[model samples]
Target: MDFDLPESAAAVREGVQAIAREYDQAYWDRCDAEKRWPEEVWRDLVAGGWHSLAIPEEYGGAGQGLLELAVALESLAEGGAGGAASFMYLLTPAFGGLTIARHGTGAQRREFLPRIASGELETCFAITEPDAGSNAIEIATRARLDGDHYVVSGQKIWISGVERADFLVLVARTIPAAEAKPRTNGFTVLLVDVKEAVADGTLSYRPIPKLGTNTVASSMVFLDEVRVPAERVLGAPDEGFAVLWDILNPERILAAASGVGFGELVLRHACDYARDRAPFGRPIGTNQAVAFPLARIKAQLELARLMTHKAAWLWDAGRPCGSEANIAKLTAADAAWQAADRAFQTYGGMAYSLEYPIARMFRDARIAKNIPVAEELVLAHIAQHELGLPRSY
Candidate 1:
């Protein structure tokens, strides 16, 4: 594989960086400190036409590859738009547009995809439940067909951007485990209208206060007998898992890109500080101790970036990339975590201060190890699917 980015990828990165340069560390710090959403960043991304680069061309998108998506995200981070993986930039395409573009019917795609591509619509994804975080098939959220509509009711924890979303790509169990051909069968995906559901009093959400990445609200949402039109169903009935499955690898690949980019940001900050800050008449970077961890972070981050690109390349080529995606996420998260820790150590007391953005990225990096799929679960997948080991979970 070629090491350099293609012309399209370069254009994507350049466009994204132009927008990201508008917001510096201080803006994100105030947003995180107040637990406020970054509306300014969101607006800039929307205006830049950077939000919908990956949806189908017919749907008002640029028809760019997912590698472009990763590049755009990384560009944002590298330009100092750090916390929340530049969620204001990438979340819509990541969770909302990609799934519908792949699996939605003509009408479903017609209604949502263009709006998403135009940055005129935004949505959240709901899958993880309070009771079933990792074991998705065992989820209690259910949708029952009732004449022309389906009644959906369930509790979803850590559902992001509920208040700001126009809709939710909701996963509900349509067939009970006992009645399914396989235990994983019978779940259905629905595109539920968030405003209508809430106005009718069928949905309510409480924002989750988080340690970092506070630009978007991580929410606990409760759905009580929400009515969704039958036409809102994504893919075939009881085939929701397959629709979700199409997006998981991309999600992992995107998460890997975010983590790897954040690692690069941290390393840059530390290296710059070490190069300039001198004590005892010599730059601190002259000391092996100060320089070594940054070097290690640089090496590991490049390794993660390569893995991520391989996975994204395979995915964009429409090849089976499950194992590669999982491995990329695992390695990138590890690299980001170590990078953040080293950044903290390298910055010393300043790391603890809110004045420095490194602390924010470091805190946010802590969440990467566990999200978009945990490292432990990625290892489980590598073992079971890649190494021919028995399924442990």
Candidate 2:
């Protein structure tokens, strides 16, 4: 079997790498420290047309798929920005472009895809609620029909990029969970105009202070009687569980890519430092203690990356990829955390200093273990679904 990336994915890597290289670790460090967005890198990505990779050619895009988008995110993380940079691809192309391209009506496609392709607009996803957390079926966000529009009210937590987003892909309940026969029934997906809702005072958000990935803000979003046009329904009303799956699988795969890339970034830094810093008349890398753990982490990184690629490929092929996606995210998150921990250990106390990027990377690498999908939930899925065991939750 061929293990190589397709030519298209290779080209995506090269293109994104060229841009990522322009922004050094110091640049990212400054951005994180100042809690600033990397506008320069974003402009360069737009200029390079990387954002258009997933948009269909008919909609002013390159007509690529999730595999290529995952590659772009991974390469960008490995190149410099760490796992935090995955938002560049996740917020727009994966969540907006791919979802709308596949599930949106023709008019919806026409309205959003081209703008997304051209980087003229940005979108954020909102699914997790203050109480729901990983139990998405328990979400209480409600969107009731009001004539031609749906009046939505809900609270969403840990939503990324809301401040900068022009649009939001919102998941709400048209039928209350208690009333719906099947747990997944009664769900509806709506596309809300963020700026309009905010201006009307129906939508507001407060940023949550976080431990890392300070470059982009995550917020607690409140939607109170927000009106969304009926035309903005992303999929068939009250049958959005299927649409939610499509969005979720891609999210897991891209997040896996981010973890693998972040692992590579930290591992590279560890290897470089280990080879150069010789304190006791020999490079620390020469010792088995430092050398062996790095080697093991390198193996883990490669294995996780392979699973990530397989998940993305399965998604592009329109195959059932839930098992693969969960596995990829779980393994990649563990690998990234291990790599960051070892890298920090390899650098000794110097890792704590701001002069080095390890502390920042360590902080960034950690969030992947919990967000998008938690490691414990992934394990639960595998335990029940893959093993054919009884449901635990």
Candidate 3:
């Protein structure tokens, strides 16, 4: 509502920017080409406490809200897409932390929060399966109670950070659809020990080769009767959909923020090139053809930023932000996609080259339009939830 960041928020944004400046486009380009994770830069973020900024102070985190988290993510992206968004992906476990904080038993929180806050443990979220994708109710992953532990067995695709994660905040069906209270019921959320799961051969993961974001590898993981202790379960069995929604809203908001930052980075590069590159003995920016499109991109990016901030605010205030978060992701993904296209056009031939950061951001931006939630699904949400239309699909 204020439309201005407070002093502490401003410092958080500025600090993230300063940290991101250490990695340049050239470094990001090399990492992408080599498909290497930015370990050193990630360590820098860990040491800076950037990874735990949103975890509660009582749990040894900075205890900031979603607005600050969005600002931090955007600042990282402002540095460059790969450079900034990598941290965003790395710190994704915090979304799980927030879910646990809100719903976990005191024992579950005590067991995981301190380690997560200290960066000794990193977590990957598992909800989107190959078959289920955005329709989470369709998730077939199953977790069955067996005395003191739950046996989980399922396959999850696009589960990021599994290679280095200490644990996973996993979602699986606990009751069959026929027995579920509603179509969304019968599911449960579990905090599984990654090391134990791997060591016992209950979980096997192979890195998913991806187009970008190589800093943290995505994984296709098979959970083969993995044993998650009863103490590790968060919230309740057969009622995780609500908790998953809370967790996902922040993920959407964070992704939208990173998209905003990436859009800004592309626009900045294009603007500089336009001001300096000459066509017809004058700056290319002099042509309305070039300048006008970039101007429109800048305007769109700002609008997306506002939507992202609004979503962040609502989530931070402990309000239901499903609609706002969905819209922010939809708008920001569109803006980033449009900005990437225009920025590439402004650069002409070089934009197609792997040497250019715009190309990488462009590829990454295209993914945002689909991953986490698709643009079509977001539009459907708006039509059904806000516009009072019947559900489609």
Candidate 4:
């Protein structure tokens, strides 16, 4: 019944907002124009310890949960950086820190968590393949046992932040989907040393030309006979479905937060422009056409944000949240896209101009519907799981 955010989560939002204020829309425009990472803001986040929200205090982190992390990302997006800024937290803290903190073996935790907490190391997730796309079970990446090492070879597409990642949380098959007894069996999650693999010529990547969110590069990563230590297996070998879900649910929740935040950002811009721009006797916002859609989107954004918080809370409480996560992602993506489209309309011809942040935000809001998980797939999940309908695809 309680709807307010916890005091700790509110503190995270305030802290991230303070940092985000230093980097205005103009700063983000420059970074987007140059296709550069927001290093200054990143360093500020590092100094503020925002990066360690999901890690355990025992490992030098704030010992927070996904709710706090989601709030931080939401605040960052609403602040002006858009959904792209969420990558700063998604790559290292959620994918690298939270996963290891929960599923990593004792030795693995000892080696990675402290550095991850300190922001000295970063990680990227590689699961989506060109052929497989949303169907992770069909991924052909293979890792074969070779003495104490697993020799891995595969290609992953649309991997984010690989250029800066020190490690890769890679999903590969020990046994092909065709050969495994259960479809989910035989999957293994490995932590690959990115620099070492690249130096030895076993790994390579090329950035894919993307429309928006240029702040971080999504790349086509190829691993050719990469050798990973056997000790690097993240969870129980051949039982990686659990680990994958652990990674994916939080990812969807954070993506949902990003969507909700982006919606708020664009809606704010649209409202500002609608109130001030007066081509006629009165402001454009005086028209219900201008004001109603924005108002409707505002309602949708708040609902999506509430679901996002619920999903995050369920995750932090170790409750099953697959349905909530998917719903949050679906509703939030729709809200963000609608908000951006409305904002574009509100700006009239000026939305296309780079002088305003609307153009960049318009582009960034779109990919949320497709990436992390597609809106259609999310709907299908709800159809099957929530309603107990027969599975589709």
Can you write out model 4's per-residue Cα lDDT over 236-258, one digit (the tens) per residue? 99999999999999999999999
**In candidate 2, which residue ranges exceed 4 Å CA deviation?**
none
Predicted structure 3: lDDT: 0.81
TM-score of each: 0.97, 0.99, 0.96, 0.99
The per-residue C-alpha lDDT of model 1 at residue 278 equals 80
lDDT of each: 0.84, 0.93, 0.81, 0.93
Show how many residue pairs clash in every candidate, following the order shown.
0, 0, 0, 0
Query: Model 1 over residues 27-60: C-alpha lDDT tens digits?
Result: 8788888877777877777776677877888988
Please, what are the lDDT tens digits per residue for candidate 2 over residues 8-69?
99999999999998888999999999998889999998888897798899999988999999
Give the Å error, residue 50, model 1: 0.9
> In candidate 3, what are the lDDT values of residues 1-393, reduced to their tens digit?
488986767988888788888877888777777776677666776688776777788888788877887888888888864334734543454555567767888887787777777868777788888898988888899999999999999999998877877878898999876678788898898888889989988899888777766666788999999998888878788888888887888888888888898888888998998898896799999999999999988888899999999998888888889999999898888888888888899999989887768878778778889967899999999999999999998
- In model 1, the Cα lDDT at residue 149 comes to 97
